[model samples]
Target: MNSIPFDIVGFDLDGTLIDTSGDLAAAVNHAIGTIGRDPFPAADIHPFVGKGARVMLQRALDASGGYDDAMLSALLPILLDHYAQNLAIYSTPYPGAVQALDALAARGVRIALCTNKAERFTIPLMQQIGLHDRFASIVSGDTVGVSKPDPAPIRAMIERAGGGRAIFVGDTINDIAGARNAGIANIAVGFGFLDGPVEQLQADAVIAHFDELVPLLERWPG
Candidate 1:
């Protein structure tokens, strides 16, 4: 068989690999509800994701009733605890995601995860989803003391995946900019938690489904 174009394929966790919006929204709502604010619909919470739990809560609080450091500090752990306990309750891989991962693995491509989700949460979430063992490397936001849109975590992902020509797949500006900052190509997912139109992301490519991944990767220019 011909070699795959990329030796390593890195992915962002929350939106790119798994749809964690339901549980995440639940957690955010739980935190906001503690302050007597109304719950936000999970769909409305999508735009607040991709950053981190703290940021997600902050955004929700800001939209609902405003927030302060003390309020955030108090609610952050509450949100995280709620999320951890219910990690996979509504989270699942996007349609055909596993098939795409298997296809990449079959081609000798290493798969790694680089997500802004903190390690404490990322680990349990992946474990609950039954995909923890599939990644060659898993770098959380806290793993390297930095988050995406900074390139540090992306670089750490590449190194941990054993170093190779890498391409990143994600669903946010942070993902696209991080890959670009790290000097790698990026593929944006159209079905992810996008804050704007997919075309506005200006990624190297865009795909509407996981089934389209392998073919796009195969045809990607070096």
Candidate 2:
């Protein structure tokens, strides 16, 4: 088999590898409903993700009524519990994601996960989707003292994946900036949750679908 350009390929969890907006929105609504707030549509919740659950809940709360530290503290666990119970009810891999993973593995590439989602949620969610075993390493926000955009977690992801030249694929500013800060190449997905246009993320390249990932990586100059 021909050698691949990258030994390790790391990916962000939400909005990158999987379309988790449905369940995430449900969880947010569940939490906000406790305070008698109306539920937000999944589409509206998409952009609020990628930062982590607390922030997502905060954004939703801020939009609906208002939020305070006490409300956040009381609602976080409830949100988490609701999400954990409904992890895979609406979550699924993005189109061609599994095929892309298989293609990368076929080329002897090691797949890794570097997500801002905390381990408590990330692990269970991946397991629920039957994808936990696919990654050589899973680095969640809580794995390192800090998360994406800090570079430390990305570095930790590389190290835990057994170390080698690596590239990251993600859909948010944190993901792209994290990879850049870690001094690695990054690819942004156009299909992911974004606050603005995919092009504005300024990744090394942008892929509209997972089917394009392997070929793009193979030809990447880095």
Candidate 3:
């Protein structure tokens, strides 16, 4: 018998399941470099993530100097191209993420992915990391024609994952708030690209490491 409460568990891709800050910063630096802007340190890129490519690039540009619509429009594709090509170079799963996934599978919980990253980038990144087959469903920013905080994509993720009771795990407002918007339980990850304190995200629970995930899930009341 499955001990976990939810039949399906959905996660946000970039910050929740993987640490993409390094490669993302590298791509941002690559785009900004073409405009002669100095590169930002990878650690500096953490807060700029979890939104999407455009927001990430815009934040980078805003930090380096300032960006006009023309500058943003011109540089978006360059950053994306670089990211697509080098997606997995510096990106890796957070500690115990794979083990957590394995434990969930062992409990017969169907895992799903819902991320603000575009399919063009998300699919390939998962492939390179060898985690593509783990998710029963993968929904990108553009997958359902709307992104998180709107609830459409997440709702779609549940349906596509063979819906039942579901809970979401994420690292940003888009993830936690989106789960709330979808009327499901949510857990926030402390180590992801948080823009503020982890508690500010307002998730039902928070975990600093993936090792704590399964035990936490097993204790879920709902």
lDDT of 2 by residue, 1-222 (tens): 545679899999999999999999999999999989998888888878867788898899989988899999999999999998898999999999999999998898999999988788899999989999999999999898898899999999999999999999999999999999999999999998888999999999999999999989878775
TM-scores for every candidate against the unseen true structure: 0.93, 0.94, 0.97
Best candidate, TM-score-wise? Answer: 3
- Model 1 accuracy (lDDT, Cα): 0.91
C-alpha lDDT of candidate 2 relative to the true structure = 0.92
Q: What is the lDDT of candidate 3?
A: 0.93
Q: 1-222 in candidate 1: lDDT tens per residue? A: 646788899999888999999999999999888888999889899889866787888889889979899999999999988887899989999999999999998898999999988888899988888999999999998999989899999999999999989999999999999999999999999998887899998999999999999999888876
Question: Candidate 1 — worst ten consecutive residues by lDDT sum?
Answer: 1-10
True lDDT of residue 211, candidate 3: 99
TM-score (C-alpha) between model 3 and the true structure: 0.97
In every candidate, how many clashes are there? 0, 0, 0
